[model samples]
Target chain A: MNRVCIVGVGSPSGDDQAGWLTVDALLDLGIRSGDGVVIEKLDRPGSALIPLLRSTAWLIVVDAMQGEGEAGQIQRFDETGWPHYGHGLSSHGLGVIDALMLAGELGSLPPRLDLYGIEIAGTTPGSSPGRAIRAAATRLAAMISDQLASGFSIPPGTQPGYG
Target chain B: MTESLRSVSIHVPVLARVEGEGALDLRIDNGEIAELRLRIFEPPRFFEKFLEGHLYSEIPDMVARICGICPVAYQATAAQALEKLFGVELDPWARDMRRVFYCGEWIQSHSLHIHLLAAPDFFGCSNAIELARIAPEEVRRGLRIQALGNELMDLFGARSVHPVGVRIGGFHAAPALSRIKEMRDKLRAALPEAEALVRWAARIPVPQDDQGFVSVAMRHPDGYAIEQGRIGVSDGARIEAEAFDDHFAEHHEPFSTALFCTYHKRPYLVGPLARLNLNHAQLPEAIKALLAETGLELPSRNLFHSLAARAVEILLALHEALRLLENYRPPDSPWVPVTPRAGVAIGCTEAPRGLLWHRYEMDDDGRVVSARIVPPTSQNQGRIEEDLRLSLLNFGLDQPDDALRLHCEKVIRNYDPCISCATHFLRMRVART
Candidate 1:
């Protein structure tokens, strides 16, 4: 019954620690599970999205990143053209879109899904996390909070969120 | 690839049909191989990182998640490691029961590979699902056979994927003798089906070779080691299970997340082929007959011959299971008492895939101070790279790139490398029954 399926992907300890923070930020926005928002923490991008998408209308996945672009850049996109493990999306063994693609093929996929890829500059092995990710996570939390406060005027599950 | 292509790196993201997500990268520069990374970028789940705060008594419960297919191997190794910490040497029946349990893992995991993984490659299909379309009965039979192994484990562990029965010292609740009897009776029927599978795989015309061999598994004074033997290699690298790190080291490379391991400054093979080559003398008479019936010989060095070797192992597991059932007795205690003490313990057992190595440094209170898990795939990483470099010469560069890429994928697939296991280490998170 959650309005948004918040699928969190990334390592909590690795330096590009923004993704884990993003999940906490989403929760700080008072996005309670089954209140039209479901939170899932995954080790990597995986097919775990299939079941989550089946019942929820809007899917918002959070993950850390290091792009050719600047750090703390939020790469938000609908993963339609994406390969299950997207080309050049070398974050981990399993990428985001490809898992959904496999889910679709396996008859376990839901239609509306969005990935909020937050780029980070580094990995902090054997420690907590970096700074850029924490700040970006805070901003993402505010933006998401604003959208949710508006009741996401988005359709029950249509067009994802960020209304 | 030619001299110009040698510098190129090929990254395969999903390394399919194995246990979990993994990848392979082969770096060849100027026709000399520069690097081979069977990368296990499955994410740092902090398995080893978290065991720091956990009690030693809870070790077995936590380690099972290291692998979905080979939980018994994990359970056995952890139990052994903790036993060293607790000063509980296993009784003979307890040891036998552990072996019987491992036999179940070998049968299930190997059967999965032979049918669901290896068979499709030889049959010209992307997956066994395609093969099922042509031979539904064969596929069904295969699934049923596979499910039988699952059922056996389910008796102890509760599920085919990861069982709950295994613990630090021994089982939580001993399996009823009747249950073992039932599994043995069922195994009697299941044995021939395994032989049939091997016979079919034997007909596939796999590329065979005399690659040098090495194995890290249990060796007994009696015969082939099921648990608790020193490590042995074809080139005479021998040592106790505790001494695995004395000769090998894990390298963290940029290409992949999985750590690559090397023995004696060279890549060496593990898993069924290694076991088959090194411990052929330890195989049982019934399995020897299975090999004879299947028209295969002992000491098959060709890695592809692993399928035949697996079938024979299945026969041995089934035989062992029956014998265990006949000689079964519930132990006086499900688990022996333990007193945690300061010590570094190392344990190794033959996973259905290969040797699974576990080393733990425990505090006086039995808290895990540090942990290192050397999964079979990580050890095989270098071997995979060497095979890739060697395989290129066989695949003339005159061939198309796509064809060559597919061949490369196939060669990598032969190892059934598991990335998830290599990346995870002990930080204890208990799963309560």
Candidate 2:
């Protein structure tokens, strides 16, 4: 039962890299690997997420979302609210939600999960995120840190540290 | 009553499930199909052109981007081609390791196609989600099997997607014996699921047709060919891999961006069906016995049975991979060092889809002078058209447009055609009058 933060990232440029940027921000805020928290950056995580979910109790996924929102808008969703986020949230081919659902079907879903989405202006091949999104990336990192420190208490499965 | 007739046109703006984007257009004139086109307008990635002037050593990883699903095929083919030009023999360990790595790919790609992509078509489900609702256990089983394939790739290549372990003369490094044993154990555990998949595929109601099309695949004396073989065609034409370009020609068509390939001025089939049909004799006795238990005869001509063929190959690959790993030992050195030489060489390997052919001409400096890559999908582009034309005739153009479209999609999918691979190398549009 590990608290795993799986960041879905893209090639180092553009809004798609928001996931990695958020991970960097979290690291800067002292969320080191050995601190009972593990972080990973993946490119099109897809079905590869299943094996990772096996040992995870709390899972946080940060990714860029495609939606009709101002650039850098932050959307926080728990397990129940995922479907309401619409299908276009993931910038990757299959997106994080699909992977989560597939994992659920395979009985590989972690008991607790959260998704942080940073809406972006665009994802042009070589372009980086807009300034607003960069600022939002920092904000989202703090929000995640706060949530993790609070013991991810917000949910359907909130049993404290059990082996 | 006065005689009257109306024209019909069916246009699918976006074809689903197959990798990448493409469309199908059908035109009907007075209940008769006047035209059918498979238009693949996905923009070309210009992989072959980009290979020019790159160091020979860099070609494997670069060409791998051609298709995520078959990156190992690209890497191995490129490595073999370059190694041939260098005139170096890979140590037996490297050769066997390459086969095992390739087996992982076949298992991964085939299982994905069978469970996630192709099987739903037979079940009349729109996608895996719906199929899951109908058969939850089956979908979960599929995921598990698919994961095993990825695990195998991870054990050898270090990571499946565009694995970096592949190098010019061999791998960048070899796996430990323990890892090999672990993978072997897992593969053995997955054997029943693989067998079940064959049985499941055997039951899928496929459209029956004796296509009588020319089937082509690689033939090796040792076993089912993956990396090495002579080109064997159903028409009894056997040619060396080096002579691939001599017998086949790629033709450009205005309607589609993918180049349609013709062997000796005729369309042919490849991929799982071709491999199984041609290499049935080469399969191990246990594998052949498993197929016999399915009660389906080998060398099937029904193109729809390609699904079954893919399932059979998955079983074969798992068995072969275990065998390759049985006596695994770390190589003295993972790769044979090579000095670049000036020459033209070719390598043809059976991708999960079909025969992937690569030819490279390099300067003495080891920089590529030119490169030509004929992916499996491009070679099947012509055969797909012929299948569509003939199958549509049997399907009857007078059927409702929706029925026609669904059947057409299934026909295209039966080949499990990778439109993305074709377009990067090379559309599809259908019109009728």
Candidate 3:
């Protein structure tokens, strides 16, 4: 019943910083940030995402992932349909899947959920993520901003404006 | 003894509900358990080996990666060791805030284990999903407490998982007073729920069996041990962290990927049960009174009481956090300057699981020359197997394989075994004829 939009950011350094970078881009675009929106930057949130997901009406998760697609590819995951593009479990104790599963089981998942994953080349401590991945993060942020500006619902089988 | 079944082998190729991966093998032949191995097969991440040549200031962050669940313990332990070597003293505010951060970990970790991992077995449920169908209210309460813990953690440490706030001498930065005040209010609001959780845990149908095992934990003169304390055992032995190496030794066993630790050549219990058993008298009066009011026995020998002990600790942590928050003051500087000195120093603190011991040898330029870390789960490995042997022997060996497996899982979960933390997911394979 709430009209809140939740954005979860990450704390990975190299390529995994895509999520954090996206949030930065969104802020730069001035996505209305009043009582209606809540943005959270987390360092390996793990299962802690449960409560946040439960309390909000709309959820958007930005994270760096590795999959079959070329690096810098952006994919969107819905509530019932999770992406299976080779993004395995998180290096943290519980990954995003663990949180989503727990939320579904507890009947606490928000009504509308959108997970934006940017395909990354590397996430090592010292290595830099590919330039394409950073561009994808900015593009992903614009897509989210446009969607939020309008009504934030996607028709069945239709893709968002941006990949 | 039932003569109908003379042999039993139980293999759970993969253990569910534990933090990491491992395996459990139980073999019973001729009415005797031939083998009971808590196999830890998770590949080591080689944290210690990689720590070499890293700047001394980076030790906290590097070691924090040891286990996501108990990162604070690793960070705090490493900081303490380096601080000792450099003769740096932390400001009082920073020291107390560390305890607050640790309390958050205890609350969240214990609540997660009790609700999501361990409790399902007590109700004949496979997981929290099934428990939700029956005990929805309890599950919700647990989630609320867990959320509060996360909130506290985020406020103080900047994030729940692998917090980066902690540094070598203290923290990277001190939080504003307003944030602390907000957290205090939330904690105070959740106080009743925490107490209710303790009461609820007290009522759980725990399997009964005495473990005549030695309990080891940290004891502090000021109050309940959280961040600072000396190691104390139930057998009246006390030692400082530096003396830990002299008394305790880790042995490599072919069966386990993790080393089995022993104190004075004997297995000892750590974690919540040990802390409660050894430091029952050290609890604040309010907590002690709450325990008396709840009517749970003190110094419990039954390993199953670990659940109740965890609940009590949660309540205590909430209370302690609130009290500490009442006197919130931001220090002029969060960290004290450290000058690199060449020395080997040891530090030990109680993780939510048990005692986390760290030793470090730093070079003159403040680079780590060598580092050794003994996490709580590794220390409890031998004791876990021993407890399993004794408990299984008493649970009546004639139970169905699944029943026995569940019982074994319960015993293992009682330790809240972070197989990942211990050098660990468990693939359980049991073979019986």
Candidate 4:
């Protein structure tokens, strides 16, 4: 069984693909499924995230989010900070935050759960992510690699391997 | 005296615990409802226009995008319709698998609604989280059942969310025997849990606001309808998919983008309760015995009985899937060859919500010329509005605004309205004297 499960949550629409693209970069960096780390890309898994969360000791979720920062800014949050993130009611049933909240209620949350948000300007349907977003995804992948290498205790603001 | 003569209005900016975005506006004058609108403000997604000029082969995948919750419904309806137009007979293996695939959708969608969306209202809880605190075991069980449904879908569709395995004649490919056995084992194991859910749901103390309305669903000759059937109305009328427009009509209201459908110019019921009401006789004997044990009578008038209806269907779906998969074998080919002809194509299936009707005009090259797809939510819109008017009045319009608002939201959510599909939901405003 994999000790670390990295789930990329998003769709094919423009910047929403940030999480999926980040997973791609991680694979390009040689993080295979058999290396104690399982990588997956889910297009709005909703409540389905609960099962995946319980399958690993450490769970890392990467997704595109709107925040008070420039596009492509990367931020990290743990379970404690999730409520402050303002989880609105999703039009499409149990969104990421709602699923996390549900999982927390069910006692299905992993022992270590990390959420990485790639700040995005917008998600246009059928469009690819812009350059800044791609660059940020690469940087985030490298940061995640470093975290895994350092026994999962790497602090935020550690410079990414990429510029 | 002057207060009694004054008019009042109440509005909710957005609805909660239901799928999609929508709001409700209620105006009261002289102690009577002056105006009420279930406004569905989600921007119109012209899925029908998008289907134009698309090849018949692409219809299943494209239509599946309409609802993440019930993609199989869209895919099945589209595939069945095109197959009818092309005169392609499906392999028996494909036929059984299609039913199994649809059962997965019913199980998942009903479980999610019963546990997460609709249950809280009966429990006096604000959301599933609150309900979980009081009923953790039940919530866990619900989640487990839900996960099983998703797995069943993945068995054939490749993935549950907007599954891509469906094709024109049948599935894109067949599942191996090993995967089928794995799913069969899971289905057998879930049967008891599903039955328990039905009993638990039947025990919930729903309001006694019984009212008369017509129930509509698909009726099949062989068994409980899921994938294919004629449109069955509680009034003893049955019609084919092509005749749907002749009896049922969709008209738009100014305040909402979703069309309100009526049977013979009157709002009628659909979805789980309606299905159970129309086809309870067709259910397996064990399921019928279970329903009898709950003491919930068929042709139930109470709208809240929808929760129990959904739970019952979950058990039924599990039983059906198991029966179909018990002797499963990999077919030589999952799909048959298709020859397209220029003509109109029509199909209807029992979505988890209700009857979903699709009509397409096909060209000689098997490309779509025009498409009109009617989802269950839109069909339930008029019925929802009508129910709101009666339920609010019965619940006592003189109740406080918050109490009234919550009541309206509960009533709307009871329908399990996929507002996103209907171009729908409830941000409610009430004006009263």
Candidate 5:
């Protein structure tokens, strides 16, 4: 069986490491290096995702987001719609919504994708990721591990991916 | 009976006018462009894969090999990240030196972009070599601007390509006051040449505006932030660099080796467009006046207008480089100490292309546990394809193969992709019986 992939996204100096804050928990989920359960972390989600998603069956992305409509909040979404984009991370680069949408038109996209986004305040390491993002990372990792243990049920009508 | 050859296959050992080496797999299936892959096989120097065990001190010099154009930006971000990790602070003088180096790269890279890489499209030519026969004087001014760019960088950073002066806390040796004064002569001489390039850029026939451009630049209230800056966007979204990861996200797709980044789930541009749109107010009076005289405005959406903006940025960098040289001073201590904290340090700097970020992990011994250096090309990859597809549609190709190919190259040049740095690619063989 192919491995499931979980990527923690955060800048270590950024206060909202709630993205990778939960990375330790993901690592502790019995994911061996190069195992069926691949745990990784990233600074930003640039083209690095190509190889990660190609090898994994399911991809669980964890990152710090802006307001969850309120602080100390976490948001989860299956990346079945337009690709999920968030602001206020270390990315002062381009936005690729229409670009990815166009990519989809060209028949290029990962089959199974899920995202766990947490809200954070300052991204500077001097400050701490408020209780909200940290708690969200930990909780999101645990829930995804539960889903993985349960064989990761595919919610209805989603396309199959290379796991 | 009559038969058709249908289409021909073409390949490039090294892709010119764009960065990196890749071959074109233009498979025209029955006269409709079946498969068009911009393949990048520039064997991954395995910068990340190999950088694992190296000391943090070795990163800036080593990773600068990733590209020739934006080496200073790479060194600056790595230096800044290392400094942040060891809790080293740079004085204003150090920052000025860094910006001076940046001015050099911006001038070199942007001039290369506008002249050698992107210019052939505006005129009707195969390359600058061809354009030279027609417009020798215009090309000479561009070469002078590019020459001065490296001259200033070599003066400060020691060399334009993979500078040696850039280290952990600060420079290896601060510039003497007299050396900076000498640069005044070169920059002053280059100023007229710079303005000539500006006028030449203004004369190009590219459209005045593009519809949607999300330029990412550093926004400082005092003036344009060349090397140091907080994150600012064209859409009025300004956040501190600390908030960078929170506000941005990357996802993977099969069609592209480069990961696509989105700011709040929309397509925004970085690089020259982002810098111009976000920091136009900080432009020098001369550059601002140049724009007025040329009849160009900021917050322009036209990707074609990027050439003009890049030229404008070179002008701004020239003015700023001169000012920085005037105020140049050697520090009592060239560098501060940086001790490993066994933690991580995040650094975000404005590469000439756009915002480049790096997250460095170190053990107690300060060996790089892992490294994540985001090049502007990867972030702009999705946008490049977007713009490419748009250009293809815009031109509505009815022309011959040569004309269409030139148009496509022009489209690719718009993003100024450093194809080498972005994750390179592969070729697939389809067996049809």
Candidate 6:
């Protein structure tokens, strides 16, 4: 069985919790570890993500992002499109893009890598995820669950874009 | 020089590889520096003010939030201060484990700075990604060592970033023997890699720009101080943490939110280089031998040697952690009970960056009435400015704006300045006349 790993990268700040909330939504949907799927949530893992990326064969990363789109917009990106969206979004020193770049340089990127980004409304400290973000997280969680159920392979010609 | 080129201004909107936001402004007049300001514009995060009214038990976690890169320093310093005021003496087990935990921080923080932040500057690369392209094995080894350090931190603190395992008396819980054994095996394996890193760092061909500055760090008679020691200055003065204010002062700079600190009104150096300068003799004999092999002298005068210093310290931290964890026994309790009394508390520790000092005034109920935490980066601000002035002069003022700006950044980043922790990156505006 091909091992599949789902990592939700986020902090607890407001809409930044989208990633973790999505993970929570996954658990709520009965998509869990065992059965060749590994679930993990990371709080601003930064470069620490490299080791995890190296350990898995198939990887799906869910994160909150700010982009030129409406709040709670869910977008899917593979390796090519992920890099373009990864820079300058993190207030932390090394963001997800930087980590992916490092992993790429080190040849640690998984054989199959997918990124799911939920457009965040805000990242106010000590605040909970807003209504739109929570809804988006749920939607993304179901989408990821369907992907996991289908043996972790994207269908051919499935264009990358907002869901 | 052309009349128009005599006065030039260079501005860097944001600095890369630094921990937080800041900028630099330089004005050169008639082939001389007329003005240079290491402007730190990161919003003043009133962490000290935020500590007011918080319970003493909350300090370790709260302070840890100050810097994601070196949260252990903040947590450990704050814990030490509160423990001192409360008359809490940690169990020997807790004490040893605390040192081990701190070792984790040193290893990880130093590794990150060396591999990701500082190394690229020396290699003519823009970032760690570029550095990896040139030195994939070194970068991989660095990441491995960094991961091992984070694992060590996680052993005690429960997580590497803003760890919550620390408390006033000791850690909230002791790590299991199984985990200790696992981490010990990893640390032992990384020893050779760390040594190789020292050799690689020594061969980096750092520029020969040595300047005069006072060196200050904590000195432990038992070992190279990490968690405890008396303040040691290069001028041969020893002081306790309580006397820190009397000997050193923090003054406001109009250009930066971070305070510029001075030892007796003169800028001084801190962090790895300072630690190695004052306490190299305390290092393990093997580490000393490795330093000798690298042909790096103790009390090194060149600031660029800081990279070497950090590498040496990483080796030291790895060895220290291994030695301590070799005979690990889970204590009945990782921490002892504490009673709070109203009084002023003070503690100091060697943070990965430099010496971190913490002070708190506690009420009878064990709540903080006031708090003052001094991080290493802010303390280095004056020295950074001083270094910038001397280094640029030595490099010659006839250089172009971009060259001058990059040189200024190189100098600042050499300190491993955590602008966020210091209330900091760096924008560079160089004005020349």
lDDT of 5 by residue, A6-124 (tens): 78777766555776777876676664456577777665543224335554556677766665466557777764653354432322221223222322332334456676767777767
lDDT of 6 by residue, B158-220 (tens): 888889999888889988899888888888889999999999999998888878889999998
Give the per-residue lDDT digits (tens) of candidate 2, residues B1-433.
Answer: 1111347777776554346666777777775666677888777778888999999888888987777778999999999889988998999999998999999899888877777667777887776656777777787777777788887777768888878888898999899888778788898999988888888889888777776788899999889999888899987889988888789999988877788999999988989999988889998898788788887786887788988998889889999998888888998899999899999979999999999999999999899989899989889988988898888778766666666777787788778787622111112333444
Q: What is the lDDT of residue A98 in candidate 3?
A: 58
Off by over 4 Å in 2: A2-5, A32-36, A83-93, A153-163, B1-6, B420-433
Question: Cα RMSD to native, each candidate?
Answer: 10.6, 3.7, 4.6, 4.4, 21.2, 3.7
What is the per-residue lDDT of model 1 for residues A109-162, given as tens digits with 9 covering 90 to 100?
434566677877666556766666777888887776676677544445433211
Candidate 2 chain B: 10-residue stretch with minimal lDDT: B420-429
lDDT of 1 by residue, B23-70 (tens): 655544555446555666666667888677788767777888677678
> Which run of 10 residues does model 4 chain B get worst, by summed lDDT?
B420-429
Preferred candidate (TM-score higher): 2 or 4 = 4
Query: What lDDT does candidate 1 reach at residue B317?
Result: 78
Ranking the candidates on TM-score from highest down gives 6, 4, 2, 3, 1, 5
DockQ of 6: 0.38
Give the docking tier of candidate 3.
incorrect
- Please say which candidate is ahead in lDDT: 3 or 6: 6
Worst ten-residue run, lDDT, model 1 chain B?
B424-433
**Candidate 5 chain B weakest ten by summed lDDT:** B421-430
TM-score for each model: 0.68, 0.92, 0.87, 0.94, 0.66, 0.95
Flag regions of model 1 displaced more than 4 Å.
A1-163, B1-20, B25-37, B213-216, B420-433
**Residues forming the 10-long window of minimal summed lDDT in candidate 3 chain B:** B420-429
Residue B153 in candidate 5, Cα distance off native in Å: 1.3
Superposed Cα deviation of residue B331, candidate 4 (Å):
0.8
Tens-digit lDDT track of model 4 for B1-433: 5544456687776655345667888887777888788888777899999999999999999999998899999999999999999999999999999999999999988888888888987888877777888888888889889999998888889999889999999899999998888888889889999999999999999988878899999998998989988999999999988999889999988788788889999998889999999999988999999999999999899898999999999999999999998888899889999999999999999999998999999999999999999999999998898999989888976777777777887898899888732111234454443
- Model 2 residue B249 CA deviation in Å: 0.8
Off by over 4 Å in 6: A83-88, A153-163, B1-5, B16-18, B420-433
Model 1: interface root-mean-square deviation in Å: 10.6
Q: Provide the lowest-lDDT 10-residue window in model 6 chain A.
A: A154-163
